[model samples]
Target chain A: MPSNIIGWARLIAGVLGLSAVAYIAVTGNYLLTALGFAAIYVVFVAALNLFMGHAGQVSFGQNAFAAIGGYGSAILTANHGWPPMLAMLASALLAALVALVVGQATLRLRGHYLAMGTLALGLISYEIAVQWEQVTGGYMGISGIPPLSIGGFAAETDRQVFLVLALAAVLACWSVWRLRRSRFGRAMGAVAGSEEAAAALGVDVARTKVITFVAAAVYASVAGSLMAHAVGYISPEVFGLHMVVVGFTMLYVGGIGTTLGPLVGAFVIGMLPEVIRGFRDVQDLVYGVVLILILIRAPGGLAGAWRR
Target chain B: MPEATLLLQFLVTGAGTGCVYGLVAIGFCVIYNASGIVNFAQGSFVMLGGVVTYSLWHALHLPLAVAALGAIIVSVALGVLTDLLVVRPLWHRRATMFVMILATLAVQIVVERLTLIVVGDAPMSLPPILSRGPIHLGPIVLDTQVAFIFAVSLLLVAGLRLFFTRTATGRAMRACSIDRDAAALLGIPVSRLVAVGFALSAAIGAIAGILVTPTQYTAYNLGVPFAISGFIAAILGGFGNPFGAFLGGLMLGITQSLATVAFGAGTRNVFSLAVLLIFLLLRPQGLLGTAKT
Candidate 1:
């Protein structure tokens, strides 16, 4: 049939996302606190899909960028007196810079070693965030974060920042979708599938990996910055390997090699705990179980269940 | 204490932790050798042994030795369950290597949390009678549990060497590690041997857990870091060889302890893993790698 099915799903999801925002705006149901969480997660996981799904980089450090994002935004706004809007962009840049350094150093590794090497970077970033006391506030975390706002009125009014985040998520998804169709995206994928083969065909393997990795980090960072603002708090624990695991799970459960996979995974997982309150205790457990089930049963993911 | 005594003391303490890592690393090697599957849940198995033993020993009032034995037995059983339930199904379907990684993670999360539900989230401990006695060696001081942990670990490693060298079953396991199909053709029950591989892996993991818990205590999330370190050790010593894994474990542990002293104590994990990464860059197979497929 037509690609209209995918379009309809996107439209319905957008409306639902907007309505969820409106519901929070009107009802002030702080349970939607998780909406901001979900929105930010969508941004991060979607960016992660660019590297992991499209480019074949099994990175576990997307959360490190998110950690950087939160801290970057927090520092810019909380300490440097930057506006919330400006702080967001700054966080993305900060994450990008760090990712650039890390990707360059570790991308030379092949196979599972590459995976391990990047995971090491993620762990170290997390440790630095925890141990570097005065800057990161150590383990207790940097708190009292200012919320995103339009003009004068604050965006901290419950679900308001989340509304903005959801809108941003839509834009990020659209941009990534467009990018996937771009020449650079194809080049990245080619490199991921076979670096030696791609190099033989004139692809600059190392540079492509570095750029793709940095771009992913930038996206994750911006999402993290928004999350810090939305939550009005940021913690070192938020940057741990668990976040990395969750990010990868979301991307893989949705579909690794597709444009929409991360978004769907992020949405489902993000909204899941909110759908049933008791599920909060075992939110991670459900995530793990469902993700494994999906990985096994539908290797191509939920969207992949439909054959062309 | 004298400098030599202090050095000896740290080594004693460090060796216990190192041996546990070695055992855990060996467990990782066994599975990796048998199926070419890197079992990231090796740490979870260690935690299970520690937590289960702690529960059975304290809550059920079993003898200490019996509790330790029970822990090994339970870990071995869980290893069987892991292979049969999670691994076998995945292996049967010939799931992608990536999916197998996630499946093992699923097993780890399920087992780890189920443990939290059974035992509380707090650090589970043994009786002070087992936990708080010490042994004096020259001018060096060693805790009773720590001393036993190191001694037993060395003994186990030596015993494993003999068993592998001397026994027919062990030789078959070795043969399978070389080539599964070839070993199967040589009248070896490859599948059963793989199960035994899991059993052996889990036993070592559990033994490490019992030794560690008296000192470090046990928690649901306890095994994760160990798994990461042990995996590093396995890589550092090559993926298939048990002795290389042991050396990797000791080197990693000593380096970690020294790294902590050099660059603040809390940042030890970062330094230790950094060392593993650096080592991997220099030698992809490992430091003392074995020649196996």
Candidate 2:
């Protein structure tokens, strides 16, 4: 069989498997709701991979962008009567613009400084979200968000929301795949490998860094919008600093810098709460242990393990 | 009613929190200097100090002084463990700075979750270590606890300054921070000092935690915000300079307090983030840190 045919076959099989999971989840409303949430995280983690895996910058502040996207769309749809989809798109673009500015400002920082700078940005964004109570509803959060709709069809139920999330996740994965195969993707790898060498080789290091940062921001924004709509509520607490750490955990567990890693990581970590439900108190403990163990034993992540 | 009293009140409270932040920031400086790895778990150690002391004193009915000591020991051990289990292994593996930083985050997660499990997630507090009631001096009114926190913070900073400059082990640690390879060549136990660095850092954080717990509520998650504030404070004063971190923390505290007046209470936290971002962009070396050659 041709290699492309094999790849297409695998993609079909994966989608079919996901559809089967969705079908089973539909019978159990709670499980479907959980999976719907997982799908949103899948998008966030995949977007993260574009930066960490491909571009090689660690953003401890992507959660801030997620909040931006979440709050941006939530406010518009909740207050202005704009369509949910349009609001999501606009918020994502806005997030990208913000990322562009932040990227230009801080991308020059090397290693530790860059990480700390992003962490500070995340803290600042969360503070802003909480303090801007007039818009974000403060700690109470904005509620009664309209369900995402298309051409008069609304996804009012968990099953429908799950379908939308899955579609979005698939699209995100597809786009990321295309991105990794592009010249820009190669440039990102070059930049990550050695910025000095990449510059020597004529790659625009700063521009590539900013573009990757903006792309990840846009991805997080969309994820946030979906989350706000799916839950019908959004708040600062939902996208706290923990999300940044958790998102990074997912990327690491699935295998950093791999196409399949994000989905795998998201699925594992997403379902993790349920898996350890019997030990309610140790849920986070389990996650912490898993994260450390993965980093130590298999820095390449689960997907990397599978390949091995 | 003197308006100056109100200003003094904010300044006093600001100084109290600022001093605690200074302590934590010094911890950041110590570890960052020694290992060149920012331990995100530094705050978790702070949380551990408070929660552990609270449990020892309140739950076990131990003496306050003894309970504080127990907390210090626990924090120091955990600090060493952080080095032995997390940092050293990763460092030996030749992990990237990104990976090492992530390792610290993992330690943070583990510490926080385990703390919640052990402490039952409730906000606990210690009985005031100082006398109750406010002391009025001219137009200023201050709590005894605030005075204790401030005085202790300054003493710790002075003690650390002497230790780093005057003591042999401390100088060894300082030498290691400056040039690990050279320090090792000079017969300094570089790895051991790194472990010592973690322990000392955690001890300072624990001290701050215990001192502040008399006036502040202790919770499992409080360490994160404290860690963040301390981090900004450290950066503001320069990453590895204890004195710089001390001054930075004080400035940050005062700014935050004043920001409450200017931007309302809700917006105060953003001040540190703003300060951090601006400093990082324009002068990453920080206020007291000399320009890197």
Candidate 3:
């Protein structure tokens, strides 16, 4: 198993996997819808890896940014009549702004404190989404969001939507891959190793953490917007704590620090429910058990193990 | 009711729920002290206490008192099992804090799903222990259940204080919290004590659930919300400080009740979460806990 051979194998497998989903989507099968969702989650998990795996931080609040992007895109496109693409970009910026403020306040904390702070941030966003009935429609949610489009070419069909989502997912992964090799990515890796040590080495640990946090938030926001456009509906539950749980499962199962881990984890986890739909009552139980087993047996995740 | 009376009523109700949060927070502190792991499954013990008691009393035709005791026992056993099956292995591996947290969360989800499968997800409740209507003290109306909560919580806190100060095992557990390696070197059964800590916390959480279930509903899904609130309470009281967690819980409960009155019930969680964010940012040491050096 030469390293280069492994790399080429992974690349080919990724292309083949995406092609399979695209084929299913073109043939009007429903599984591509799930793949579409997996694509959105890839963006989330990959961005999260930048912070958690690369920079050594914990945040239970990425869903907050997703909520912001979701509601932002929903309100902007559905109510304000902004174009969907423009709305998505605006929502991403808004998420980044919110993340900047939150990250500044919270990035000072380490370990469990950071986790708890982010968790609160997420719950606050959820509560607002549920309570702000006039704008968000409360639990009823917002629907009829315009699909993603560009200059008279709209992603109207499931295939087109999946294509758009797959592109975003690929771009998200590519950026993370590139960033991991860049100087900033090295800084993140250093910070993850030891913040005190990184600081001693002249890395601006605080600034690097804040920037990465904001970037992750932006990623989550875009995913949220894509979700809204793809599903044509947006609800508070779409970006709730469950999203955090699912994202974590994917990130860990695929390999937290690995480049292809998010994509692999997202697809495997996303498809798991459908695979075990018969055991609907025990779905969460299985997920929890599988997660624990993976953590104990293969903490590096599938992608990480493959690299080994 | 007059304005002051309405305020008093909210405070009384808030105190009742606060006591439950305090108990759950204490559970968190106990486990954290013993094992340096925050057991996210603490709330599941509370859920089990209520749900199991409901089944024993309603379906199995057991006496309510016996059922409550049985529920507490079951939760304690599950807590020990969680530590032994989940925490101990990871503890041996010296897993990172992130992995430890996620493991407990997974345990919590498993417990919740198991509860759902065995008992179903519909909300259940027990009859109030006192079975009397609300008690009137001046213009303030307090439910008999609330009074019961106060009595039990007081006794438990007193008992906990006595155990820690006077008992050898309790002191050993405290020793482990300060320094596990040192405690082990000093011949304390640190591993057993960790299980004991889990059992003690689980019992407290179960009691809280049993007491509160009479006032409201207990469903499988309520565990996460209670866990979040309890975690906030722990932070507010200062993490790993059981007494502080109790006070924090009371404060959080009162503030939430007041917020519900001021705004609507819908904004109650928002207010509490806001308090959490504020506290985490400004006063991470909490009210009673000293700042870590």
Q: Which ten residues in a row have the lowest lDDT in candidate 3 chain A?
A: A278-287
Q: Is the docking of candidate 3 incorrect, acceptable, medium or high quality?
A: medium
Candidate 3 lDDT, A104-160, residue by residue in tens: 888988877777778778877888898889999999999989889888999988888
DockQ of each: 0.45, 0.61, 0.65
Over the stretch B44-161, how does candidate 3's per-residue lDDT look in tens digits?
9999989999999999999999999999999999998988898888888989999998888888888888998999979998899987788889888888999999999989988998
Query: Best candidate per lDDT, number?
Result: 3
* TM-score, every prediction: 0.91, 0.92, 0.94
Which parts of model 1 have CA positions greater than 4 angstroms off?
A1-32, A150-154, B127-133, B184-187, B290-293
* Candidate with the larger TM-score of 1 and 3: 3
Two-chain DockQ for model 1: 0.45
Checking candidate 3 for backbone clashes, the offending pairs are none
Q: A1-308 in candidate 1: lDDT tens per residue?
A: 23688766756766886676677757867756776677788888888888877887767567788888889988888878788888888778878888888787778765555665665677677778878898988988887789896578777655566668778888888888888889888888789789889899888989998998998998888888887888788888777766766776777667777767777778667777776565333766676677667666677875565333
Worst 10 residues of 1 chain B by lDDT: B126-135
List residue ranges in candidate 2 displaced over 4 A.
A1-30, A278-281
Q: After aligning candidate 1 to the native by TM-score, how far in Å is the CA of B137 from where it should be?
A: 3.4
Q: For residue A161, give model 3's deviation from the true position in Å.
A: 1.6
Worst 10 residues of 2 chain B by lDDT: B266-275
- Model 2 clash pairs are none
